[model samples]
Target: MTAIKTEVAGRTAAPPPRAPRRRAQGLQGSRKRAGWVMLAPALVHAAVFLLLPMVMLVALSFTDYQFLGAYHWVGIDNFVQLMSDDRWRTALLNTVLYTVVTVPIAMAVALLIALGLNSGIRARGAMRVLYYMPQVTATVAVATVWLWIYQPDVGLANSVLGLFGLPPQGWLTNPNLSLPSLMLVGVWQGLGAKMVVYLAALQSVSRDQLEAAQLDGANRWQTFWNVTWPALGPAHFFVFVTSTIASFQVFDLVFVMTKGGPGSSSTVMTYEIYENAFQGLQLGYAAAQSVVLVVLIGVFTLIGLRLQKVSSDV
Candidate 1:
């Protein structure tokens, strides 16, 4: 009787172990499927929107899809047309040049403002509101105000210059001054947001580090160079990347002020793309120009990322 009981007990234990093994396999399977289910929406969005549209753009760039209601793939024709065209070349150059000039200057001014705001002066709150007001103001209003200021006579800008004994000048009419004038507005409108970002970053700097630097007899400039600036790595990276991208795509101010020029001086890539598609009625060509701009922006974004502490903890 004892031997028989032992045999039955051993058989029952083996079947219970087998049942648990099966249950483990079933749970693993369910987890794997749930993981895929969680990612389905993101995958669907990329396929339907981003991936599909990009694929269409590349295909359309090769074809003559302007207004003929017919598709004819002419390999490299669009690119060839773009390169041979002088106007397009000029517009491309202007875009690149504007990007180079405005990005650094805007970034510097934002840094200065950020430093000022961080220093906690009297009426700091009022000053912060003044800087940020441009962001909340309507674009049309801003442009209108600037137009009045830029007027050659009876304008605030010229009046101020008269106090300095400078001659009256055309801020927007002179091709040389038009781009810079636009840059001034761009700086004013953009600096506030970036300064806010930098202020947030400055607040996070380790107080101990700054105190220790002072204890070591480090001057304010030296302390900022070593501690404060390093803490601002992420904020600097954010402002530079976004402002550079925005600079390349500047159109509204150009449209409002210069309308592409006194000889195409203000015609950046975005404006050119607009002209080619809408005015020129060369949709395929415009798409190709857009492709080039996309590539250029991608290259700049990568460079900006590399310039900051994106990949490193420092």
Candidate 2:
């Protein structure tokens, strides 16, 4: 009877060990399947929208392809040809000039506006809304108003100049002034958004720290440099990078106002791409240019990120 009891106990314990092991394995498999099920929609969407389009673009860049027309593989010929394209060179230079000119000036102005709003001034909220009005305003409406304001004759801009006894000037029509003129519009349009961003950042600054700086005999400018500016690092980086990207991709304003003229004076990368793909019908070459533009944006973005990282570490 004792031996029989021992054999029964052994059998029960052996099955208990194997049973839990089998159940755990099954549970792990089910969890893995559920995870994949959860990710399936996102994966499918990325494949359809981003991955597939990128693949097609890269492929098209290697061939002499047009919209709904016969295409032939041309290898690197298109890319080689694009290297010497004068129009592309001019567009690249103009884009760089626009970015350099607009981004710093806009950021500086936005910071000042944000700082002014943040001060213990009456009607601060109203001022903020007023400053941010341009962001929500329709681009077309803004462009149309700006077009009239830039008119060589009886425009608002000229009228303002006349008040100061300054002569009326050709704003957009002059090649030398065309890019800068468009840049002013760009700065005005983007100022509101950047100001809002900086305002949000300024709110996060420590009032106690600011007060401490004042107690230590620091003036307004010194307090800002030591206490406020460092706190706004993230916002500053974001505005700088985004402003740079927007300047590079400037197309709509050029299309509506300049049409990349006064003879390509204000042409940018995006405008060039549009002209090539739609107007010139050189889809392959345009795709190559698109690839170049993507690279340029990526390079700038990476540089910005690296600088941000370095600043944060410091």
Candidate 3:
């Protein structure tokens, strides 16, 4: 009433509306609170499980913390020892070899499978489920089955070789064959998940662009390189990073199948860490190895990201 009288008498113009502005501010505040509420659980989990353990690991790396003995600060002694540790070197090399061999093969094969499936292949759903079975299966169970499959005497592999008039080969026992055998298993287990990612990416590719490329007389390979591949950039990066990390952290299969043994031929960094921490009781040294593994993973991931960026630019 006072505002109306003021407006009528022209004594003072009514103030600009404040309610809408205040309401909007209030709504924005509520939204922010809601977002934080939604994120709290994940943030807490990371802090507790990831960040805290990482901090402890770094701290432990500088101390000789054996499980049954008193510990003391050793500065960089553990890292220095790793420099001359032949076992550590062997583990690192084998791990790198495994990662290099498995990741690209897995990605390429998965992408091909995805492309085939995306083309409306018959029984596509069944095929996808079949391929994905290994991924969903327990790693221990998969490794155990593979263990039987790799057995020299009565294994499926040797039987198949016999059918081909070839002698039975020691798949896991032979130093030359152990790592490769593991690589095959790694690639096989990983393919389904990678294929699913690629299939989704392939489906999202622009149909109009593909048609345009076809109309321009581009061959299948040319069309794919120009239209489909570029669109899969995100998928490629995701798969590469994840596959690399998984490869680096591979342990269960080695533990179950090889035990890094017949010597250290099949040993990888993760297995080495486990051996040192548990079998050898060198917790500090194992922590240092863990740190190195983390560093290597970070470096490789960065290299992958850079390569992806360069490829995308090209």
Highest lDDT, which number? 3
Off by over 4 Å in 1: 1-47, 309-314
TM-score for each prediction? 0.85, 0.86, 0.94
What TM-score does prediction 2 earn? 0.86
Question: Model 3, stretches more than 4 Å misplaced?
Answer: 1-12
Query: Number of clashing pairs, model 1?
Result: 0
Cα lDDT of model 2 by residue, 1-314, tens digit: 99999999998877445888899999999999999999999999999999998888889999999888999999999889887989999999999889889999999999999989988999998998888898899888888999999998889999999999999888888899899999999999999999999999999999899999999999999999888988999998999899888888888889898998889898998999998999989899899998888888888889889988888887
Which is the winner by lDDT between candidate 1 and candidate 2? 2
Candidate 3 per-residue lDDT, tens place, 1-314, comes to: 99887778784565778999999999999999999999999999999999999999999999999998999999999999999999999999999999999999999999999999888779989998998899999999999999889999999999999999999999999999999999999999999899999999999999999999999999999999989999999999999999999999999999999999869999999999998999999999999999999999999999999989998898
- Give Cα-based local distance difference scores for all models: 0.85, 0.91, 0.95
Clashing residue pairs, backbone N/CA/C < 3 A, model 2 = none
Of candidates 3 and 2, the better by lDDT: 3
Candidate 1, position 81, lDDT? 96
| 210: Cα error in model 1, Å | 0.8
